[model samples]
Target: MRSDVRDRIERAVDLMSTRMADEDAPPSLDELAGAAAFSKFHFHRVFRIVTGETCAQALARLRLARGTNALQRRERSVTDAAFLAGYGSSQSFAKALKMQTGKTASELRNEPHILARLVERLAHVEMAGGEAGPRLLAIEIARFDPFEIVAVRTEALYPDVAGTFSALASALGGTQGVTAIIGRAHDDLEGGVDGRPVFDCGFRLRAGDAAVPAGAEAMTVAGGEHLRARHIGSYRALPGTVDIIYRMILGRSDLILADRPTVFHYVDDPGETAEASLRTDIHVPICRIASPKEKESK
Candidate 1:
């Protein structure tokens, strides 16, 4: 696909995502197509071909994902969750939940482990659109010792990750010991859309003398070797960038993925920076296999 066409489709996807996050009602097909500057009919065909799901299917999945988060909240009743998810009634919400997750609403609420499994399953569901980007700018490998960090954890959506950084900055309070500002995703985009994802947004802490704030938690990033890539542009394009990286990782026989969550270091403040100029460094952990000759010698 042409890069221009791919970018247009991505713009449409971004619009749809913004609407879904902001309002209970999904945007009309005409609105989405218009956002892409395409005719409604042609947009429909291209959208499905590019995203692998119909527009309606994509909307429904997004709604169901949001509903899953609401249903899991202890403070919100099932009826309340259903309404918040834009469903007319609890019956309809329950039916949709079951259809998507193979579990009833009650089952999800009462069984915490079941709910966890459901969240994991949802996290793996790709937003059915957009081909992966053709390339990443520069890839590198780096190693480091475990580093201490002070951060605030939130259940904010992926789009809000940048928004949460300010709170972390405030918590840091111009401390001279602060290093790089980092954001780590505890769940994937699917999990984030479902509202169950946890993100630790904060800065790396240098040694000594700085006091940890009341609400912030201090933790360490496990020291290890990792595959790194620099992503430039909107955070919304991260999934595609990540997809390309994973593809590259899988294609190599001598590389082994580590059991670790991916880490993103923000190079620019999203709140102060335009989306088009944002920069983030992504790190994926890996273990390298020794060459056959080296293995034999060992």
Candidate 2:
């Protein structure tokens, strides 16, 4: 496949995943096509060819998978789960569950062992290997001290970083003592793409450098431990990298997501380096494991 075509499909997949994860109603075919910048007919044909599933089928699978997770985690009642999963009623949700997994929602909810088995099954289904599987070069635990930065924010999607960064660079105007270039994603993609998500493109500032440009603001990145993964590729492939990280976290009981946004540290300048050789360190904030007693109480 052509690189441009692959990037378009990836963006479509990301949009689909976002909507499904948010438990929102599936988007219309036109919406998906528009997101990919393709005509509706061509987009449908290419999406099926690339993903091996039609748009509707992919959405259904994701909804059922997330519904299973919710049942296993005890996060919502059956009726509530049905609504969130885009099913009209508990009866319809149960029927779909049985068709997909050969088990009813009540059975999975009432039986701890069965729920565990279902969780394991759903994990494999969710992270099934694909052509654009994650290519993370390394993973590490790192600590960052609080640091200030001046950023220009925008409500754009991935692969559109150049414009946002350019705006920030123009704002800085040869300011001295820059530490690093960073991209911060402020929205949870898993929750549906409703309005545009916010992205902050900026440079880390030196200590005591309090000069803030007009139309820009200074903010502090909190100090804490984070799970960092190094991704070596084009910015277009970052979604695949993030998917892998989420799968890793799901497989481990010791890690829980923190309430902070994910950060990307660009280690190489794109203008000087080829896209294939670019490196980005993605940091996801995480919390330590909970005790078994604490788990039981919850």
Candidate 3:
């Protein structure tokens, strides 16, 4: 990525943080455009190009993500969350919130924690459209280590995984970190048998040496055995590639998937499409599925 473009994106994120901080603030598009060093006419398009959403789309997403987080974990009131997220009134927030989620604000607050998780997961559907690129280079077991990431996560399925990844990358602006899409490609893990095709998709962020920014918290990937593969192709073909990898490797039973697969786009270039040169190293954490004899021995 060009340093100039990278700098502008960081500036845009900074401007967004400032805008969100002011409770009474109604920031103008012109200010955001200036902060991004983009022309007012082009800012909306450019911002969407870089972040996978228009400025308004990103704002709503961030607001909702923050509001949901507050609603579920912080025990904060819906009224407070509404205002904190720049909503004019709880009524307005509740209407939109209920549209996105089946539950009303008060209902959501009283609902079980699982309901909140359901809401969080359902919110990711809008981020999937993005530029398609070429396949990622192959990777091996020695390439990565257990590391930490802080991210704003969602569960919506996107039209394009590459676009979803781009939003994750944008969310990490101003930080020295790699934004990666974490997910399990398919279930069943059996060869030649098309089983259920469900996987977990979320973001993995690595905090850099720089001071951690507000609202970015830390989470860790535990150390364990993993099955690794490097895929080189268009984004659309990844699901099949992942399926193929599982069939070949897991068929041999050298590893069994401990959880979902992690698609690591370690060398993503923000300025270009994946077709220009795509590279994502996928890792599925695994352990030996104990045999009957092993269980008996234990």
TM-score of each: 0.55, 0.54, 0.38
- The global C-alpha lDDT for each of the candidates, from Candidate 1 onward, is 0.69, 0.69, 0.52
Candidate 3 residues 236-257, lDDT tens each? Answer: 5555455444443324434444
**Which model scores highest in TM-score?**
1
Q: Model 2, 1-298: lDDT tens per residue? A: 3445557767777777677777477776667877877544235434554555545566777777667777866768888878778889989989988987787888778887877776555433221323424445688778898777888877776667688787777777754666788887665322223434467788887777657888888877766878899888888887567656654553466775565667889998787899999999988776778879988999
Q: Against the true structure, candidate 1 has what lDDT?
A: 0.69
User: Where does the lowest 10-residue lDDT sum fall in candidate 2?
Assistant: 123-132
Which of 2 and 3 is the better model by TM-score? Answer: 2
Where does candidate 3 stray beyond 4 Å? 1-144, 158-171, 174-217, 260-263, 273-276, 288-298
**Model 1 Cα lDDT, one tens digit per residue, 1-298:** 3444557767787777667657886776667767876544245445554566656666676666667777778988888878877889999989989888788988888897778766555433243434434767699888778777888888776757655666666766763666787776655533322334567887887767346787888877766988899998998887557656655654466765565556788887666799889998988777798889989999
